[model samples]
Target: MKNVSLGLALFTLVACSPVSQKNKGKKYFADLLKDVDKIQLKFFNHGDTLAESITDQTEIDIYKELITGKRDPKQKIKCDSTGEILFLSKKDVILHAWFSSRATGSKYDKACVTYSVEPESYGSALTVRSGQDIDDYYYKLRSTANRMAQH
Candidate 1:
C-alpha cells in the first residue's frame, strides 16, 4: 500500500509539472502587430551635417532613444560606413537595418531612414521604401523595429 501511494504521488507530480514552450522563435510581438497601423514615422533632415554628426556613440544614443526611450550617454556603438544601427532582443529577434544618403538629386537626399526589419520566423522581408510623403508602411516598420529593439 505504501509503494502504490508513493508511485501515485510521483506520477501526479510529474503530470502536474508545467511544460515550457519558450524554446526559441516564439512570437514576442504578437500583440504589437495589431497596433502597427497606429505608428508614426517622423522624418528629420539636417543634410550632411546630420549624417556626419552621427558617430558611433551618437548613433547608439539616437538608437536607444528611438527604440527604448532611454538615453545612455556612455554606451558606445561602433558605427560602420553604412551608418546602420542594430539591436537584438534576448530572444534573438533582430532589428537590423541601415540608412544612407539617397543620392544627390533625390527629393530627400540626406534624410536618415531605416529600410527593413527581418525576423527569424518570417521568411519574407519587410521593407520601408523611400517616399516623399510619410506613409503607414514606413511607420509600421519603424515602430516594429523599435519594439523589437526594446525587447
Candidate 2:
C-alpha cells in the first residue's frame, strides 16, 4: 500500500508542479514577434540628442509592416543574428534602428546589435538590436519621418 501511495504522490507532484511544458515547442526569437505587437520609433542625434520620433498609429502600423515584411516568417529571426541594431527600444520603450557606416568585411563596427529580456519580473520584457537589416528599417523610418516633417 505504501509503495502505491508514494508512486501516486510522486505522479501528482510532477503534474501539479509550476514548471511548464508549454514552452517545449518554442524557438528563439519567438518572443520577439509577440513583443513587437505595438512598437514606437524614436531617433536620436549624436547618439543622445533627440532628433525624430514616430508614435502615431498610421506611422506605427507602417513601421511594423515595413519591419516584419522584411523577412519570411520561417526565417525572420535569423536576421537578428547579424544585425547592427535595426530594431532598438529605448527611452520608455521607444524603438529605434540604425545602419552601419562601416564596410561589410570589417571585423567590428560601432553599430552592433544587443538583445535583452527582463527577468525576475512579472513577465518577459524584451529589448533588441538590428544587424544586417538596419538599412531596411532605418531608411524607411528616416524617409517616413522626413515626409511627415515636410507636411
TM-scores for all candidates: the values are 0.22, 0.29
Best by lDDT: 2
Worst lDDT run of 10 residues, candidate 2, spans 118-127
Q: What is the per-residue lDDT of model 2 for residues 29-72, given as tens digits with 9 covering 90 to 100? A: 33343344344333332342223344344544444433321222
- Candidate 1: where is the Cα deviation over 4 Å? 1-59, 67-83, 89-93, 102-108, 117-151
What are the per-residue Cα lDDT tens digits for candidate 1 across 6-75?
A: 9999998777653322211224333222122122222233332111111233333333333321223353
lDDT of 2 at 126: 19
Residue 35's lDDT within candidate 1 is 24
lDDT of 1 at 139: 45
